[model samples]
Target: MSGTSSQGEGSPGGASADSVRRRRVPRAERERQIVDVAVEVFAKRGYHATSVDEIAELAGISKPMVYLYLDSKEGLFLACLHREANRLVVAFQGAAKAVAPSPELRLHAGLLAFFGFVAEHRAGWVVLHRQAAELTEAIAGAAAEARRAVMAEVADLVRAGIAESGPASRLSAEDADFVAHALVGAADSLTDWMARHPGRTPEDVTLRLMNMVWVGMGGVLAGRTWSLEDPGDAPH
Candidate 1:
């Protein structure tokens, strides 16, 4: 049975004539491989530095294969961003799920979930947070969408905190946004800093952020006086 017939093809029943003809991968698995390679390439070379050739090489498929499945380089990077960002969002949402009915606790769980994602998938974070900054057009929009999606959850928490506690509402939506941005910035900066200082546990970083944001947010929204700690009154 030569390779001509659809019966026997490769050596001794190893490859069917039809199999040798060309096995078609399911769309889902092919998409997964494309995304996996895209993540690695984008993470390693940054988005601008990566090429479809590199992804194809890493994926052991033709460049056209990637294009066929994921369109262009921008498309591939965007897909990776969407997949990874969605994963992080889901993780944070899951964490917020088991929260003990306190906005404070939910916020803490959300922080924990975020750090856990950042730690486990540093590459994903880099692509979402770093590489996205370097891209333009639709790619940049993907980043914005992801950033907004994540931040919206935080903002919603803030809104809830206001409604439940009744004081945060006094602050304009702009004021609420300002507070959300500050808390987000502090958490992100601390996470980056925690990565630099390996001696400081991430959990410790998370807790430090938790205490700072939760106390401040809770107090401010609960209408408590804003307490300024003296430089002399705090731990180093």
Candidate 2:
């Protein structure tokens, strides 16, 4: 009787034994999967509404496993934000590095990269924006800092443009700063618009923006200023 009981306890049924033998995923891969699913869920349902259970279910892992990897819902959300934000920043950096030396061309390349990222990772954008709305001392600070870095990059590009322009069109540091901030704001707003307007392609959005921003820059660079006093001569 003792021998028979030992055999049953050791092996259980075949199915049960097979489940117990299932392979465990690597820690890094598991954490990545959890964050990826969390981004999707958090984006679809705002951060406040999302749950770790849902993320775990979507990721084919246990809730306890998610906690084991990410600690808590907030941690998981932060991880998602970091991952996506890093992706966007890297995309911009890579594109900027690959482009021509012209400042305007570099700016154009960055805009194209930015729009392309939004088009491909809409969910990521939603999470990042949500981070802005639900600010906290810790996670929100990180998110804000990430944005500031991108804005600073834009400012650098603007400064370069100012230097490249003719003396008449060149702007002071203060003016360049203002223009950089304005350009960043416009791009952010347009990204939201693009998300809602599925019919528009990233390339199309980039071209329209170039027409607005680059053309205006061209006027200033050409030493032409528009004013009510002289409604600039009509285009030929």
Candidate 3:
């Protein structure tokens, strides 16, 4: 009895000896952890001020391991940018699909998804929008590419809206592009506001944006115009 292992070389709790061994993280999982920590540190300290050592420490991995896994500091930052950017794009795409009947509804859904993503992933959002600008040329380019991709999605939504409304919408191709750019710019700016106002829900943000966008589009379609020269021609 003394020589034999009653618990199969494990503790009396019945876990096998092998089960008690240190858990090994898969390569992909570890890489994700590194990017996540990098995002947090980079967002808090800005890209130039953030150090690999700090990220490695927060990730519970060695500095050398981080370099080995991510290649270099720039590489790690790029990885974070790519991952977070793709996440937002996918979130918007899925929301667009979820509300397919109306172009305006799809846009509302997309905005809701966008705000929710930013609220849930504040660190990732900050890294993509704020810290990405502080990085080197190559890294900044990667982040900019991501923004362009999201803008393209918005543009597609605008195209859909114009098509659905036919000639009544009165939005030309050029006009749609311009509106898309404006919407994307407004959303980007509002995201910063959402970050500062954590108490605001994604639904609330989406509704406010929808009001501004749809009302303006409605006015444009209805041939309504406003001018400073006409004192009574101001927008309500």
Candidate 4:
């Protein structure tokens, strides 16, 4: 009968155990904390050089616990990729959606968000942009998927712009797709350019890009065509 009563708060050690349990982080939060630390380490050292032990130590958790939560180093890296990629997509989508319905403004907002994310979350951007590609097929696939998602968003905006131009607009859906690929590719390469030119704000980069691309796009939509035959039209 002495051990019959449950371990209530009055029981010796019961209150402390209860408190510890209460203080224990939720699984999702704990995983996120580990991933946060992992992102920084992986960004600094890259995937090949980064160790799970380092990540665990930085996270204030044991190495095995990191493995337990994320399954393995690859899994942890994959988790980082998926999270950062989703974050980038969401930032871009959110900014574009929050803007006025004009496709030019929407594209500008989305691009500003993308550049801003790269500037602010440099570690995350490095992980997603630099680290994901050279890994295993699954990792490569994830990176590719992220690229496709961004491309799709850009394509949709281009398609809208083309539609709004009415019958005078000469571009088609294929043109939208082509423009999307060009824009996404240019943006990817320009991140390096942006790194070199820190003085340029995201808005500056976005506006420059808009002028470079959208001005040409506007001309194209108005049924303008360029050819080598026209030498006088070339810029001095």
**TM-score for each of the candidates:** 0.82, 0.85, 0.85, 0.90
Q: Per-residue lDDT tens digits of candidate 4, residues 1-236?
A: 21212121123454555565555666798899999999999999999999998888777666767877889999999999999999999999999999999999999999999999999998999998988999989899999999999999999999999999988988989999999999988998889899999998888988999999998898788777676999666432
Estimate candidate 4's alpha-carbon lDDT, on a 0 to 1 scale: 0.87
In model 2, which regions exceed 4 Å deviation? 1-22, 227-236
Report the C-alpha lDDT of model 3 over 137-200, residue by residue, as the tens digit: 9987998899899988899988887787656666788988899899989999999788688888
Worst 10 residues of 1 by lDDT: 1-10
CA shift of 93, model 4, Å: 0.8
The best candidate in terms of TM-score: 4
Candidate with the larger TM-score of 2 and 3? 3
lDDT of 1 by residue, 1-236 (tens): 23332231112456655565565456688689879878977888887678898787777666766777787888888899999999989998899878898777787888888888888888888888777867878888888888888888887777667778864446556766776788777776776786798787657777988777776665566555533775454332
Worst 10 residues of 2 by lDDT: 2-11
Task: State each model's CA lDDT, in order.
Answer: 0.75, 0.79, 0.83, 0.87
- Give a tens-digit lDDT track for model 2, residues 125-199: 888865544755667877887788788888888888888886877568887888888888898999878978999
Quick one: ranking by TM-score, best first? 4, 3, 2, 1
Best by lDDT: 4
lDDT order, best first, reads: 4, 3, 2, 1
The collision pairs in model 4 are: none
